[model samples]
Target: MKFPISWFIGLRYTRAKRKNHFISFIAIFSMLGIALGVMVLITVLSVMNGFERELRERILGTVPHVIVGERAQGVTDWKSLEQQVLQAPDVVAASPYIDSTAMFKSSYAGTEYGILQGILPEKETKVSVIEDYMISGSLNELVEGEYGVILGAAMARNLGLWRGDKVTVLVVEGSTVSPAGISPRYRRFTIQGIFETKSELDSRVAMIHIADAAKLLRKGDKVSALRIRVHDVLNAYMTSNYLRANLGEDFWVSDWNRSQGPLFRAIQMEKTMMFVLLTLIIAVAAFNIVSTMVMVVTDKQADIAILRTLGASPSTILKIFVVQGSINGVVGTIVGVISGVALATNLPAIVKFFEEKFGVSVVPGDVYFIGFLPSELNAVDVTVITAVALLMSVLATLYPAWRGSRTRPAEALKYE
Candidate 1:
């Protein structure tokens, strides 16, 4: 089988044994460096992708996409407002809720401050994932007059409270005015259910029936806010604007971006910084390619002279070297991509294994937004990484290949 002269020569040169052992070592090192760099970059970026995905599915899933409320006071006619908001485009579901800050005290534990939410059990499932995360009992048990409370898993553990245990809830805004001074309003609630999301929210949020919440907050038939879920969460900001315009100036519309935007933005910024920093690894590997090619050109000067004496052109010499370096880039990139994808795909299981073996949590449920590592492989990110590596590899070959082509047959022959 006949091959093109340039390609045939290039392939032979790539596999040819070099007299200098150091050059061989350098070639191997360059390939390994590129491979390692590509692998690490893919793995890290996948983990970052995982974090973003978890934020969307877990955090955003729990929080309302948008909240519409009266600017001056709670919404007294929330049912009418809910119907109105639901009629707006992109809005899928709406639920009325009462929110307040309260201190929970258990007989066995100290007081813990948390956000207390009042939700209609049947309607809550339409807006939040709380019902899906319930570990024990049921949200429906939170009867309107029962004064039952559903505590987050971590919160329950912290307060050492269990189902059927009674806890005291003190609301600062609902304090009573006395002859001497104002006293905090308090109520007793029976622990009816516990939910676990393995997030920070699990340690900071508690829920009860909206009717009970209104009574405790001293607000009759009124809700603090109307939580609305949209068809596309990413378009919540635009939907919020639409709601604001449609609902008029009497109400204020807020979206998840206002509440959780900073955290989301920080994650994105960090991902970008990491990509920039890690690209330097591939660049360094490319430099090694430059060094390896330079050394090869020096060792093959006599061969270049012989080829030139036999009528080989300088352009042919350039193609040979470029092909050799590109082969290295292509092989390293292929290997790295395969290995990196495998590692990233199973990162969560690997993390869980180590955590169980070591009996220590890398991501604690009470601290981070998620308790386990998450990984997502994006095609765009992988393509960008591979392209950047190949481009760098090709660029690194230019100076050395050009110098090799510029070799003078007469001068090279005289030295030989």
Candidate 2:
């Protein structure tokens, strides 16, 4: 029976010849290396993607989306500005703010430095995301009441204060400068309730009534800034631009992207850099593919001479070796894609399982944000990684495939 081109020759080329055990082992190692490299890259990238997502949802969602404020001076006619800003596209709400840094003495007589954010709770939902983040107590309580305070969970722990506790703010509101340098002003406040954001902000920030904060901070009716929340996060920048264009020269609007710009950019750069460096591991494995194919070409020379004499073209010989090399490449690529996707898809559960059983930590929360390896499998990422690995594998086969095709029937059959 006349055999098919692939069956008659290609199958024979890929088979593990009994005499070249070392070549077979090299092929196995190359495939394994590719599989491992692809798996690790996919897993790590997914974790980074997960981190980015968490930052946006948990961190940004808990923070203000935009801040509209004056330059070094202060906002004029804020209610008017609020109306104008609200007219911008995607602007959901606007809240006036009186934010300051001061030292607060707890009930235990121990004091610590922190941020005091004075906001009108009634209007807060218009501008800040904080209202939705209320784990306890009403924002109305923080607004209508005098000297009421809301403390972050971590800040409450550090200061040793609780609801209904009185804490005094020792403001260095620049001295009543005598003949001396300065004398600090003191402001007293009552802790209203504790709030948790589960972010770094929770450890150093406190919230209070804008009216009360103005009274205590000696700012009168003047709010330091205008906090604005948008309906869509992606349109934040465009809305900010609209506000900036209309809100006069003294006022400026900044969106979440501009506010968190540097931090996110750093993450993106670091992830890209690390991924590039890790790809060298795949390159090393491709070199193994080269080594294996070279050895295969040497071991299969006599078979090459027989084929050449039987009218197989040099290109046909090349295809035979190419197919042989690509089998290792294709097999490794397929297995690696499967393994990587599987590991990425189930990474969180797998880590949890191991943690429960062995009490071992794959990631730590204090060191890394919300610890335990988080994996978010992106299909595009998998495709890109697999394509790159296959490219490297194909490149590695060139020299050996060419060498196999160029083998002379005379010399190769002389010792047959």
Candidate 1 lDDT over residue span 1-416, tens digit each: 87768787878988998889998888888888889999999999999999899878888889989999998889989999988998999998999999889999999988889999999989889999888888898888999899999999889999999899998999977788889898888899999999987777788899999999988989898899999999999989999999888889899999999888898999999999999999899888899999999999988898888888998899988888888877788787888888889999998999999999999998887687678898999999999999998998889888888999999989998956
- In model 2, which runs have C-alpha deviations exceeding 4 angstroms? 1-8, 15-17, 107-109, 122-140, 172-185, 231-235, 256-259
Error of 2 at 353 (Å): 1.4
TM-score of 1: 0.91
lDDT of 2 by residue, 315-336 (tens): 8888887777888888898898
How far is each candidate from the true structure, as Cα RMSD in Å?
2.6, 3.2
Pairs in steric clash, model 1: none
For candidate 2, the TM-score is 0.88
lDDT of each: 0.90, 0.80
lDDT of 1 at 31: 82
- The regions of model 1 sitting more than 4 angstroms off are 1-5, 309-313, 350-371
State model 1's lDDT: 0.90
Any residue pairs clashing in model 2, and if so which? 93-126, 94-126, 175-183
